[model samples]
Target chain A: MTTTNRQVRLAARPAGEPRDTDWQHVEEPVGEPADGEFLVQVMYLSIDPAMRGWMNAGRSYIRPVEIGEVMRAGAVGRVTASRHPGFAVGDHVSGTFGVQEFCLSDGRGVTKVDPAAAPLPTYLGTLGMSGLTAYFGLIDIGRPEPGQTVVVSGAAGAVGSIVGQIAKILGCRVVGIAGGERKCRMVVEEFGFDAAIDYQSEDVRKALREHAPDGVDVYFDNVGGDILDAVLLRLARGARVVICGAVSQYNSTRPQGPANYMSLLVNRASMTGMVVFDYADRYAEGVARLAEWRAEGRLTSLEDVVPGGVAAFPETLMRLFRGANHGKLVLEVAGGKGTGTVIGEGGSR
Target chain B: MTTTNRQVRLAARPAGEPRDTDWQHVEEPVGEPADGEFLVQVMYLSIDPAMRGWMNAGRSYIRPVEIGEVMRAGAVGRVTASRHPGFAVGDHVSGTFGVQEFCLSDGRGVTKVDPAAAPLPTYLGTLGMSGLTAYFGLIDIGRPEPGQTVVVSGAAGAVGSIVGQIAKILGCRVVGIAGGERKCRMVVEEFGFDAAIDYQSEDVRKALREHAPDGVDVYFDNVGGDILDAVLLRLARGARVVICGAVSQYNSTRPQGPANYMSLLVNRASMTGMVVFDYADRYAEGVARLAEWRAEGRLTSLEDVVPGGVAAFPETLMRLFRGANHGKLVLEVAGGKGTGTVIGEGGSR
Candidate 1:
């Protein structure tokens, strides 16, 4: 193994859509793990749309990653070396390991995952931050009841795909809104969603009215802007709108607000914003439940793993904004193997 | 007394602000009470900002008034004749008495008010729907805590005035946002708000930073639009934003969405919409508490009773949008006397 580590660092905050020039690809010598610390070889890097928001210099749920710092990201990796009692060599762990081939951690926020229970990349997708976000934001905040109509935007993405499945598990009639026909098909046919609205092709408002005839009881919004306003107009009385992520607005110079927010008043609804980190204390509960659901064939975990080294990090992350990736967009490191690209088995899980 | 009932009916739906052509002034013979109904002589008409919303053609908390229908309003009146066993001829009562000299009710939604406990106009202001709206919205939705900063827009209006005083009673550091220096002074000095933001002359965002240095824990938003966006930027972690009214955007062809709503995600806050009618079952609870506060001199009730009786309904209601009314804008019928125009006494109550 090479003793050199490669890292993607934030070079400059982009005005709009981030470009390759906005990142710095650099190399550094791998450092040894100190006491109570572990060295991780990042195997599968979770490329999320929130990465765009983190690059901006402003207040967010978490502090903005400072300029020149290694680009922050969530990743699943194997412990290469460990001085911490909690981790051992070959132990699979997931954490905010950033965009790098090698990571040094104190094992503070890192949690061990069993590679046998689910695929390694699944840890970065349905069984990790994405899953937890959907679990809490939907069940806890959205408060979806049985027989209720639940609509989700960006429904084929990491968080939203899982959100739709969870809503189905809870006996809700799931309707997904995706950018393309392929994603919409995958969500409905493969992910057990009752209906799909191709926001790019179909009129989302009209489609929602047809599919959700009783009106949408809960809206799990990943894409904000016009999609959010459209969902706002279709909300049922006393509905709950879970503001999970605004992927549609993150790349824009100005994030569009939901002009139809008065629908909240007309329907006596609520819009609440949530961050997955807030449920850290209950992550184990979420992971266990998701694992059981996957075992029961009731949950679909889809991951779109791009086969490229860490050098392709910048371009790979841009696929989220371009609507090119169908599921969880992940960057598989060069040396990483057995990172499970299990497709069409047990319904795209 | 003249048996002619003069009414202001809706002639047409206005494109933006209601014009004189939109109202149809007509006269009719006063109808008598039926077996279970009571005939009321409307003494104090409550002209509210919500009147603008009611004129709009769409789904709201209540049905929109059709063209040629009597303009709906809440008013305090005396029971001139009662066929209902629950009410007496001399009793003072309040209900959806509409914009007219006389009203007939079956005693279903009407509630008896005490002119001796507080003045007749006081029932239309602090002891009526305005007070109940502020009470439930602020207490239940905003959930302000002691020592927390509670910021309210439309701070000198009917609902906003009560919201600020109630926040103070709950030990919250209250900040009111109003137009012009006169109303700002009234909110801070007369209504006992800790500070006031004069939105006309100052930058709301910059003013918020100075007045609510600790960040706004609860935002009681009555005037939604740019002001709501500004407050969204200043929200504290886990803040609660109460969507009371959007008087500022009532006349706009398209309501402006809050561009800074992502602050909700960053702060893990919630914005909820509430209608006072939702708490109709608990009106007694709110009324008892507000009445107690008024008796204790902790709550201030301000009313700007515009003369010219029911004929001034349209023009008096316009004062709310123009920011001309300092407190609760009301219309006193010509025959109505002893309604108590106690200006600046007991701190604008």
Candidate 2:
């Protein structure tokens, strides 16, 4: 067992995009589990667009990660020591364990996982928070009907990719909006999306008009800005806009709203926000359904595991903002067998 | 009966705020009602902010008034010539009777009103589209609970005044936002709003922080733009923003969206738009409930009935854009006892 736990902590809040100086690295001796607590050796740390929001000094769906605290994150790990009745040593589990090599938990908000059923990193990706977020936001909020047009921004990213696939599974015509040609092709070809809009080179409004000629019935918005405005213009009557995240606006000094919001009035539509944590009680059902889909080979879980361990946490997180990371971006903390499954640069598995 | 019908027609679409050239007054021979139709002697015309949107050459909830067509309007009239089985002669009725002294209708989307039960102008104000708008937008969309903070913009205007009153009636803490001191005073004093914020004299965000200290739960937005952005900043968790109208942006060449829309995601709230026409079937229920409230003295129906009849149609309609009209702005076409009830210059009855 490792004697020292190297952790990354928030040194300061960033004005725009986070800088290297905003993070501080330190090593602390691994501590033993308390009476009811278990000690975890974090295998993979989830890097997400929501992390940028957590670095802010204000309120969000979840409390912001305070400066000088271990940067809050979700990670899948193996229990090295256990005192809690719910956890056993060598068992795989996932929880809100900060960006560190070792995490101590009382089993609160932690769920046990079977590594034999799925890869360990898959627990941090599709079968975890990202999967749950996509499931609830798309199913509960988006409510895509069969044969309806379902459009999603950030379609190549973690939550959005899963959202598009789930929307497809629900028998909707899925159209993805992503940055590059590679991502657009990957979404359409690999993810089974009906069509994909290359927002990088093509005009999103024009592309959407051609692809979704009937207009978007369900728009799962992860990137809120001009793309959101484009989707607003093509909304069908009584359309549902599911607000998942706003990665595009997270770094902006001033976030600009969807200028075509009046489209909502004209179409008699609604824009609703969703937080995955709100549906925490029903996560087991979501996991079971997602697991069944994966087992049947109908759903694919793609994970982008960057291998420089916890020390590379800050840089790995920056990849999300730059649209550099494909699939579910994760920091491979323990350098386990999970990092060995590198199907491609695009992280298709 | 008059042989000539004086009518207001749309000559051209406006570039920005409507110019005088956009309207043309003409006289036409009064045509008799054909089989299954009725001839209505228009008594009062309802002028609304939505009129500005109707003149634009594009799609909205309804089609725009075509060039050279008699301006579209909602009016209270007496059926002078009836060939329809449903309507009788001398019956007071309300319908989309164009801006004219005499209008021919097949009685579709037309309802008979009781002039003796209430007042003639109230049918075009409180017991009309504005009343139904406030009812459904507030109850169905806003869903204000008792003790929840309900905020409304354009509080002195037709729909907004009733919205604040309805929220107050639902046991909510109501805050009204209007352009002037007199309007603010009218909302709080006569309309029974808990408080009022003069958007013209005070910073709306600052005023909202003081008035809606617990945060706004249901925001009934009538004048969207800066006021919409201001309210977005003060939204409570799970707030419902009901988009009824955007009078402030209706005339703008390019409507600026609410910049703080990310607040919806941060607060896990929703912004929904509604057109009252969608609730046409339930208008009877809304009118009945509103009439009961008016009879019990729990609700006040204020009307700004502008004199000078049909000839003053253009100028009377301009009052809505200038925020000059108090309560529901109506054009009194026929010299009647209803216009004699000008309780105040600010129109607070």
Of candidate 2 chain A, the 10-residue stretch with the lowest lDDT total is A340-349
Query: Cα deviation of A109 in candidate 1 (Å)?
Result: 1.2
Residue range A175-241, candidate 2, lDDT tens digits: 9999999998989887889999999999999999899999999999999999999999999999999
**Candidate 1 C-alpha lDDT tens digits along A1-349:** 4578899999999999998889999999987789888788888899998899999997788889888999999988878777888888777888999888889999888989888888888998989888999999999899999999999999999999999999999999999999888999999999999999999899988998899988999999998999999999999999999998898888899779999988888889999999999998899899889989999999988889897778899999888988898888889873345334211112210
Who wins the DockQ comparison? 1
DockQ (model 2, Cα): 0.70
TM-score of chain B of each: 0.95, 0.95
Candidate 1 runs further than 4 Å off: A335-349, B335-349
TM-score of each predicted structure versus truth: 0.96, 0.95
Clashing pairs in 2: none
